[model samples]
Target: SGGPNYKVALGRRDGLSYATEEAVLSFLPSPTSNVTALIDVFTELDLTTKDLVTLSGAHTIGIAHCSSFENRLFPTQDSTLDPIFAENLYLTCPVINISSTTVIDIRTPNTFDNKYYVDLLHREGLFTSDQGLYEDFRTKPFVIIFALCQHLFFENFVYSMTKMGQLSVLTGSQGEIRRNCSALNSNLSWYAVDGDGHDGKVF
Candidate 1:
């Protein structure tokens, strides 16, 4: 694979910073978001539903905070959950109003794997978004597909990441190149040119 080794072209200008409740709410896709909604978002950014599911498989690597799913543990829960899974969740999350920074995934907390889909089948999904995958018939088949083909999951992941990298890219004198990754001082502020720019910026 003769992939080009290239430096990102820099010099892009930063834009006005403003945030609204509605804007934040619109961008945060809930687990219950349907295929159509997902498709619309992707289309808006020149992507596809296939890319949506493929990229989402990246969830297998991280933990969701307890606040993300307190509803599942207190007051009411989906009756479909296995009692053992529910009990395990309680041990990890507890009943008290704990901080939102609790770990939910007990398996491979730092590695990518199909354990998320497996967890879903067992009713061990930590967030409503995670659990919603199985609850929605449209998404369940894809979840099962990911669970079955580990190699395919990895392959698709790579493809989606590559595609995502191209979306909204700022190149050719568009953004400032950072000299120090941590230090943020520049005559002209830089902006992220791709989708991954927003990563780790929010919970």
Candidate 2:
């Protein structure tokens, strides 16, 4: 069987510097960000609404901090939630004053899976960003599509990722690839090598 064709592009440079804290706070999407907010962010980069829905599938991986969605657990939750789902999330993300340790994506917290959409149907989506995708009429259909078909979800996710990668990027000539992501320029930094080398670092 023939696999997808591949090509190499050279001269991709690393950015001299990453976004600052203020820059991140100003531009990074927040859990409380609504559909309009998401649209604005995507528009800034010329991404379409379809790309937005497809890229939003990134929620399939990673966990949301409890602080991001504690409101759903307290006061009242969306009536669409199954009782068992509500209780399960409540147990995993109890309302507490802890710094930032609780997680909301209970099922397959670290893996990329369609469970994120399943969580949405149950009103258990961890982030307002995640839940907002389902609430927005423009993206809801794609959300349902992703929920039902894992293969389709993966295909769209890859497309979205490809589009996202087209956004402004830093070239290696502009910056050095930090051996340690956590400690950007620490020469004494001890780096841990995983099975995939540098692939596991979040940023």
- The lDDT for every candidate, in the order shown, is 0.64, 0.68
Worst 10 residues of 2 by lDDT: 1-10
lDDT of 2 by residue, 77-181 (tens): 755556787687677666644345444456766777777787787676767777888888988888888889878877766776667766777654455455554
Task: Enumerate residue pairs that collide in model 2.
Answer: 13-170, 13-171, 13-172, 14-171, 14-172
Per-residue lDDT for 1-203 in model 1, tens only?
11213344344333233346898688667654545676677788777666776767667766666666767778775576678877877776787477755444556556677766777777877666666666677678877887788777777777777777666655565553444444333322443334655312221
Off by over 4 Å in 2: 1-10, 100-104, 170-203
* Alpha carbon lDDT at 160, candidate 1: 74
Model 1 Cα displacement at 130 (Å)?
Answer: 1.6
Residue 123 lDDT in candidate 1: 80
Error of 1 at 141 (Å): 2.3
